[model samples]
Target chain A: MRALVLLRAFSRAKAHTLLFSSHCARRHCHAPAKRERAKGPRILGPDLPDIWRSPPLDSTHPPPPLIDANQEINPTIIDGNSIAEEIRSRTAEEVHQMKDAVKKIPGLAVILVGQRRDSQTYVRYKIKACHEVGIRSLTAELPEDCTEDEVVDSVSRFNEDPSVHGILVQLPLPQHMNEERILGAISLEKDVDGFHPLNVGNLAMRGREPLFIPCAARACIELLTRTGIELMGKHVAVIGRSKVVGLPTTLLLQRHHATVSSVHAFTKNPQDITRQADIVISAAGVANLVRGSWLKRGAVVIDVGTNPVEDPSSEHGYHLTGDVCFKEAVKVASAITPVPGGVGPVTIAMLLSNTLDSAKQIYGLNC
Target chain B: MRALVLLRAFSRAKAHTLLFSSHCARRHCHAPAKRERAKGPRILGPDLPDIWRSPPLDSTHPPPPLIDANQEINPTIIDGNSIAEEIRSRTAEEVHQMKDAVKKIPGLAVILVGQRRDSQTYVRYKIKACHEVGIRSLTAELPEDCTEDEVVDSVSRFNEDPSVHGILVQLPLPQHMNEERILGAISLEKDVDGFHPLNVGNLAMRGREPLFIPCAARACIELLTRTGIELMGKHVAVIGRSKVVGLPTTLLLQRHHATVSSVHAFTKNPQDITRQADIVISAAGVANLVRGSWLKRGAVVIDVGTNPVEDPSSEHGYHLTGDVCFKEAVKVASAITPVPGGVGPVTIAMLLSNTLDSAKQIYGLNC
Candidate 1:
């Protein structure tokens, strides 16, 4: 069924392109001014072809104008890499000023267990990010066979260390290890990942603010607001209900006064319901689960899905894909975030920001 | 605007009844079965007249058959009084059994300030309830001019008291006092109202269960589930997003796998959004805010609003009204809960149950 959906999405893209080209030929043939113009047609709705498609331009059909073309025909590409860099740079500046005043830098400790290559890569990136922003990095690597007690012991060491302002446990610990026990061992004040129950509770309640928000969920909303999408009174359909992402995102959205709907795996006619949203955020981790047909014509889409689909052409033999069918959706949606470059980069930036905030709080430095 | 909405609701109800009576005279003039029948027409759509009208039972047509009358007309009234009584009885039975096994009954502590008449009445009712259920009640009455420290000190005394299993501070603390500080002073173990941050956090996250949920929120879900309204895969619209009721209710409903929409004060065209819901739970605190026209035909409504509107005819000079315009809603909804008897009774029953559970946990008795 997954393969069928993928094939169908690709086929829809092809079908739309063919229909667009034929219609363009007939329309341009009748209007000489349109052929002469440098800019593309005003493609504001579902009639527009996917932005990823490169249509040939020659003297007869004269290439659609390059200037102002994107503004007219293309979906807004939310640039997470630049946004992440901006945040990181601001954090680094803050760190520089704090260290100069206090003679101490913020510190973050990470606990990792088992030797998953992906986990190691993520840890390396986090540590590197910390260093880039002038924060101290403390690492404790435990063996896969280590008991839950050993994991908790490592976390407790960091909890007692006054230098460590934040503690993060790389998730998906060894199968036998109890995750709750290990995560709970971290002190709530230094839980920069915002997975602690108290932080989550604060996030869920009104008039109570959580010290930190789960970075990924915060990044999603940050991207939207940074790009100037209005959230108030708008209907947002959240396509997942996971504690870390979906549920918290729903809470945050509702807090922002958006009429929010939470649609999960058990929801009936999920497509029909999701299509009513002015903004659709899919965090279900299901690759290409949301198709072009599942969205409203001008909906804003934030895809938090980072599932790996087998891709033989890639050097790694796999490629990251989002919950949305990008090729098909770009034509339908008004704005969209690409999979790997979108929420992932912003998420790391948010984590760094959180760590810095925690340190500032400890040092009594207002930011 | 509030008065306009209320007036419109009453006018709509009157119009529907007049239209129905006139239509009945014309349609049932020839049908003898119609005049003999106790049941009204099967009104199942937006255009149907309100079902509450009782036209004269003259011999225009003979009385219709009496069998299966309910199958055709009259919505199911969710008798909160009966349901609450049942829950209280069961709680009493559990309390009796626990005392039999461990010679100790559960205890509850309530702290009140400023002596609001309603608050005093509620507190008295709670103490009376505790006595009837074989539980002990402790009350601390503070003056309206009491300092914040005095309130905190009172909470501290109860927190240290081993006999007190649960602590509840009456809400709407004097404007000068900080509610969060006062509420936070309660020990997590004895925070039977479940207002503690950790408990709320557990409630928000999956795989983690809070020791208790705020009673009113739980009562709303209990009423629904006990009445056999399936929450899973259903659309539940929660009006209002207050921390005590609306927000927690939304969280609980989403956790139960329902597609939940949170409509708050900032929501635009709330009636339009509410009409799409299969179940509507209103806690907005505005009397007669939700009109029959705002609901979908056959929708189930759980009203948690308790507001007093001036009524010259009433002995108290005012009468309690729910957020829903109940008189108009009864004709439109499939099932509805009355204001005074609905969530109010269930809420108190839930409090008693929570106190008992706290005692059970403390005694290491598995229930």
Candidate 2:
């Protein structure tokens, strides 16, 4: 990735934030708000009015769905936690059957470069998921000051081990290290994160499918398809253009024949674009970015944002929140995913699924 | 390409049409009219009005631009032939300077797998361009009955040739051959066509640039940028989704921060969507598919289609036409690209530029 090249040019302080800030702060909170909100430059014409913006919803339209965040009878609240449990149960059964036939179970290796609290929590969740699915979990925890070569060496060890069917490098390696070099070092066959360029290329292309889709991206699409929501010809606006979630998810939606619009940090009037969408998937990781007014009537919303906001009243010092203003969006959306229990659960489930697939592929076993 | 894999599974007749029909018929002309006209499957909530369609140009709206299909006084006609000639001249000067410095010039090797007349014409044009630019052009002409292994072997020879800085394998190879295998065999370093997955991956990524972009796709963007057309925040509707042109172009546009909507064969009511776009680039190779009614009054239209339609008045039985109906669209669009003289000429020039770039990269010379 070009990020590797830029890292070498970045100042020590800049590189530190670039590499570790995502894990340390939990949100892309580095840039100045004014600078970030400048909006992308206009290229099509001399400043045109935003044609996508819809006027305020009037009573003539169907009344806004009831706004009751605590109510259970409004729109169908997608139960991602339950669906993930179902997936884990099925994966466990498959592991059991595979162990009986091949005398081996799937194994996952996660290489954590630093002791960032957030990264640690994610790594722990993945290991727990593997355990629940009856698969072996191995972790290589390196120090904060570890060399890039050292990180690669740890990955190489797992790549060489026949028992390790899947390898995941915990992201946001130390500022001093080259993230692309270490990630690229992972053998493609064992790359469960699907961050490898080859896998991404295959995903972007037609007539070619990625061997492994990024877990979070796959989970978002899985939620829609599993819910029997047809994707063909739908106008799905994706709010976020990050490599991990937004970009790949757009490609996946396109593969399903959905007309996708990617609204990123530079997008002008993102709400206007989201309102026209038949389905909205936001992964900007900005708390309460999407509000009730941004939704079209009966729009399906999938919130991939997991921003931690300060909450002194809660047991923890902070509480996780989604990009959408869930309290308000729930009243307007036909279906919506809740933070903490939404895409997170399904993402872990997908990691387990990918691991099982890798093991099956290695053994030439049919599912 | 997935088309290559599907070729293996297709009946011989289907495979023949799939691979050779583009060359034989000069466009995607085999499908039934009804099937081609049928709207894409519905995915967004039930049948809805064509929301994207704009009303006819009236007094309320600005009057249509001058009706000037035969005249050249309204929108600036992008003179591809002149621009390509300028590119060739500059490339020649670069080759001269490099030869003076290092006593060597760039060499390009082209592998022709079959005797398709259309394919031959394209190959000849490339060779002529190379000659004009003072680059050595090597041709390896294989028969129609050549095996897939033979094609790969030909590419391998070019890959090993230290003198060759660029390698191009003309598309629409013989029906019996595996297109992907042969294309993939070309060394990534000398992939002038830029179809390699690595190059595509780089193109799709943010903060990353491809070693080489597909020439035609590059030409399209080059025209926009060279003409001082701003791309940022523009709603660019791309009317094709082919790997060679549409898909890569969309990725390139996104890199420029454009809000892009990809309209493809599966897109329903494409006219509605096109009318809403500030800029439209169509590459479906469907003659006269875009009409005046489909365009915004001041939109910029780039037609990449070069479909050969029956023309009794011409010396040849057919003449080239574009996806946009020039007569109707020219009156509506602020700027428009003509069929044969637009993207086609720029494509040949881009190949020269790519070859020159390859030489610079290989020789460690700065431009």
lDDT of candidate 1 over A162-181, digit per residue (tens): 79989999986776655655
All candidates' lDDT scores?
Answer: 0.73, 0.71
lDDT per residue (tens digit) for residues B1-367 in model 1? 4234334433443343333332222110111010001012211101111111121122232212222435543777898888888878988998899889988889999999997988998899899989888889999999999998999999989877878889999986776666766887776667778887777776776545566778888888878877888887788889887768887788778667677888876665667667778899999888788888777678899999998999999998999999888999898788899989998898898889888877776665662
- lDDT of candidate 1 at residue B8, scale 0 to 100: 47
Task: State the lDDT at B360 in candidate 2.
Answer: 73
Q: Residue A58 of model 1: what lDDT?
A: 17
Q: TM per model?
A: 0.80, 0.79
lDDT of 2 by residue, A126-168 (tens): 9988988899999999999878788889988887888998999
After superposition, candidate 2 runs with Cα above 4 Å error? A1-74, B1-74
Error of 2 at B240 (Å): 0.8
Best by DockQ: 1
Which stretches of candidate 1 lie above 4 Å from their native place?
A1-73, B1-73
Q: Output the lDDT of residue B115, model 1.
A: 77
